[model samples]
Target: MKITFLGTGTSQGVPVIACPCRVCKSDSAKDKRLRSSVLVQLKKSNIVIDAGPDFRYQMLREDVKLLDAILITHSHKDHIAGLDDVRSYNYLQKRPMDIYASVRDQETIKQEFSYAFREYLYPGVPVINLHNIQQGIRINGADIEVLPVLHMKMEVYGYKIGDFAYITDANFIPAETMAKLMDCKVIVLNALRKEPHVSHYNLEEAVRVLEFLRPEKAYLTHISHLMGFHEEVEKELPGFIRLAYDGLELDIPNSWSE
Candidate 1:
């Protein structure tokens, strides 16, 4: 399995407009992020987790020609805003994009993109098939396990595919959910900044979770401008943990491969 970090920044993205922070002013490419998202490329299909506001640009930047499905982590605008842009893929693939989300997020999708659900759809509207996630689901020949975590009072989803797990926009991970992540070789968790956040994990909390999970490798994502320079934060992390930047790629053995 191959994973690509499509966007590693938080909802507002890096270099928040008009904010004069040193990390924002830095010229390094690693300092630039475009909201949080990931592209998982499997042998039979390509899946994108979250389609943030930068989804279009992310797709264009990566020159993606075929996308089989999208797995939504929550109803947050940053994670689902770019969903409308799937029209481009619809045009090219000549098929409705398969989208998996919780029932709550499905409601948000309907409310936010009401036009798409209209009986008499307008031309050029994104074509999508919404599937409400239960415990887990299969798509494009891959089975994905959905793990529920808490984002403040709201429930959010994290996903486990093969030996990889990804969680974002979360602050509290229940013990049940943590159990699902035990065997994951690689895990990605959101770390909004250095300080505590009501709806997201701070750097320290994220590291603590990583330490407990003891994954072979753990990456921090969904970063904010306040997270400091990527290089600086990276230097402070343990050997098993690293800061994930946009466009970072990792290749892992596909257990399903024969």
Candidate 2:
């Protein structure tokens, strides 16, 4: 299986407006990040996690022509705003793509993409078949499961798609969720910055999760400019846990046994 990091920036994305930080102005392409999202491909089937505002740009950059499904973690705009861009795939396949999310998020989608849900609207608008998933639904043919997590006070979600698990926009993962993610070979978590925020898991908190979860490897995403230079913050992390940047690709096994 191969996974691609589409975007790694936090809600505001990297290079915060008007702030002339060195990392923001750096020439290295690694410093640039769009909103956090990922694409997973298993042979012919393709799955995308979160369709933030940069979804269009991410698709264009990767030249993606088809996708089997889209999994949403929450209703946050940065995570679901770009959902409309899936029309390109719908247009090409002449079919609606399967969309999986919690019931709460489904309501959010109805409000956010009311045009797409108009029933008898534009034939060209993207059409999605909603599949409301709760805590432990298997992903179609996959043995993997979804684990709901608490992002501080509000509830966001994390997905365990076999051996690879992704949890972004989360500050806390309760014991139950942690238990579900125990054996993951690769774990991706959000690390917004060095300093603690009210909602997000800062770099330190992410590190703590890495330590507590003890996955084979951990990758950090959903970053903010507050996290500082990619290389710099990465240097401080343990070898088992690395920071993820846009366009990063990794090949891993399916722990959930396909």
Candidate 3:
């Protein structure tokens, strides 16, 4: 499977409105990040993890032709706002895109895009098949399994597919969920910034999680400008862990090989 990092930045992204921080001002392309999102391609499957604000550009830049499904982490605006953009894929593929999310998150989508739920309310609003995911229920066709997590008290989900796991917007994963991710060969997770934050994992805490989970390789994403230079922060990480940048691709072998 080829996993692509569509966007590596946090909610505000690297360049906040008019902050003009050095990381934002830097000419290096890696420093310029969109919101958190990823595209995973395996065999004929083209699944996206999170549909952030940059959904259009990510697809166009990658020349994505068709998308089979979308797996949402939570109902946060940054994660689900670009959901309407799936219309392009729906038109190209001539089928409805299956969206998998928790029941609460599905509610958020219905409320946010009321017209999409009703056929007569608006035309061309995008047709989507909603699958409400209950924790620990494995979807057979998908190589991935949904691992529910906690962002503080709120329930969020991270996905484990084959030997690759992608976890974003999660502050903590309980002992059981952590065990599930241990099966991953390459782990992609959110590491907000250098300092601690209430709702997200800071760099130090993220490192601890990495150590315990012990994936062969770990890449930090959902970064904020406060994380500092990409190169500089990366240098501080252990050899097995690196910072993920947009368009970064990694090939993780199936766990059967391990």
Candidate 4:
């Protein structure tokens, strides 16, 4: 399986509009980030996680010709805003896009894209099939485990597929969710910045969680300009953990034996 980091920045993204911070102005490509999202490719399926506002460009940049499903983490705009663009795939594939989300999130989607659900639909509105997340849900033969964590008081889902796990926009991870992630070989988590955040883990807190989980390799995502330049911040992290960047890809074996 292969995983591509579609975008690794926070809600506002790196180089936040009109800001003059050094990390924002850095020349390195790693410093330029879009809102956090990822594409997971399996032998027979392509899945995307969290199609934020940058989803269209992220898909186009990756030249993704086929998409099987989308798993939403939460209803936050940065995570769901670009869902309307799925109409492109609806047109090409001649089928409604399958979207998996919690019951609460499904309501948000209905409200945000009300036209799609109207009795009389527009010619080009995105056609979506909303599926409520449930236990033992499989997509194209891949087993997905949902890990629920806390983004402050709100619940956000992190997904575990094969031996890889991804969690973002979370500040507190419940013990049950931590248990689910304990066996993952590679884990991705959000680290908003260097300081404390009420709703997201800061760099130091993120490191602590990773250390406890002790994955073979870990990545930090949903970064902010305050995280400092990628190169500089990288030097401070444990060798096994690195900050994720847009367009980065990873190949994972079905098992560690590979």
Local accuracy by lDDT, each model? 0.94, 0.86, 0.87, 0.94
Compose the digit string of candidate 4's lDDT tens values, residues 134-184.
674588777888989999999999998889999999999999999898899
* Least well predicted 10-residue stretch by lDDT in candidate 4: 249-258
* Clashing residue pairs in candidate 4 (N, C-alpha, C atoms within 3 angstroms): none
Model 2 ranges off by over 4 Å: 138-140, 256-258
Better of 3 and 4 by TM-score: 4
> How far out, in Å, is residue 51 in model 3?
0.2
Ranking under TM-score, best-scoring first? 1, 4, 3, 2
Tell me how many clashing residue pairs each candidate has: 0, 1, 0, 0
- At residue 212, candidate 3 shows an lDDT of 83
Error of 1 at 190 (Å): 0.6
Error of 1 at 232 (Å): 0.9
Total clashes for model 2? 1
Query: What does candidate 3's lDDT look like per residue over 103-177, in tens digits?
Result: 999999999978889858566887888887775333335556888888989989999888888999989898888
- Candidate 4's displacement at residue 111, Å, is 0.7
